[model samples]
Target: MKRTDIDANVLIAAFQGEGEVCQRALRVLDDPDRKFVVSDYLRLEVLPKPTFHKKREEIEFMQAVFERAEHLDTSPTLTGRAYYGLEI
Candidate 1:
């Protein structure tokens, strides 16, 4: 079985349910052969519980993923954004 780390954008896209993106996310997530994994850092980023009042459905979906998916190592902190060979 192949395992892959799921990014925040994929989860966000699925939650938002934007046309092609949502379809793609669902397809990958529904597949049984591929195993999807997330880190503690990513769990925090995409599944924040404090501000889901307006997106109850999204929160529920995200929670399901968080509960079902395999968790890896802790997420790394973003040191800085680099551009033009400089940290910005």
Candidate 2:
């Protein structure tokens, strides 16, 4: 299967250890034939957890995901529009 873009909500659900969602995420991750694509913005949004103790494991797991997944760079035009309302 081609690489897929995993959304933030799915990551959140997996991190929170929701049984079904975690299982689903695991299935995807376990598929050797599949390529996973993740955006750098998504990584930045999900990596930081305010509650340190609860988030440590999640952060570790996400770091592992990052190691395995392809990260899509946010273009300057996109970043500028998102953060500074500047149209490129």
Which candidate tops TM-score?
A: 1
Q: For each candidate in turn, give its C-alpha RMSD to the true structure in angstroms.
A: 7.6, 5.7
For model 2, how does the per-residue alpha-carbon lDDT over 1-88 read when each residue is reduced to its tens digit? 7787877776676767567878887777778887789875776567645233466677777778878888888786765455452111
What is candidate 1's local distance difference test score?
A: 0.69
Q: Work out the TM-score per prediction.
A: 0.71, 0.67
Least well predicted 10-residue stretch by lDDT in candidate 1: 79-88
Off by over 4 Å in 1: 49-54, 75-88
Q: Which ranges in model 2 have alpha carbons more than 4 Å from their true place?
A: 50-54, 76-88
Score candidate 2 by TM-score against the native. 0.67
Worst 10 residues of 2 by lDDT: 79-88
- lDDT (Cα, tens digit) per residue for candidate 1, span 1-88: 7797888888887778678989998888778887888766675676544244456677678778877788876524441221123211
Residue 26 deviation, candidate 1, in Å? 0.8
> What is the Å distance of residue 47 in model 1 from its true position?
2.4
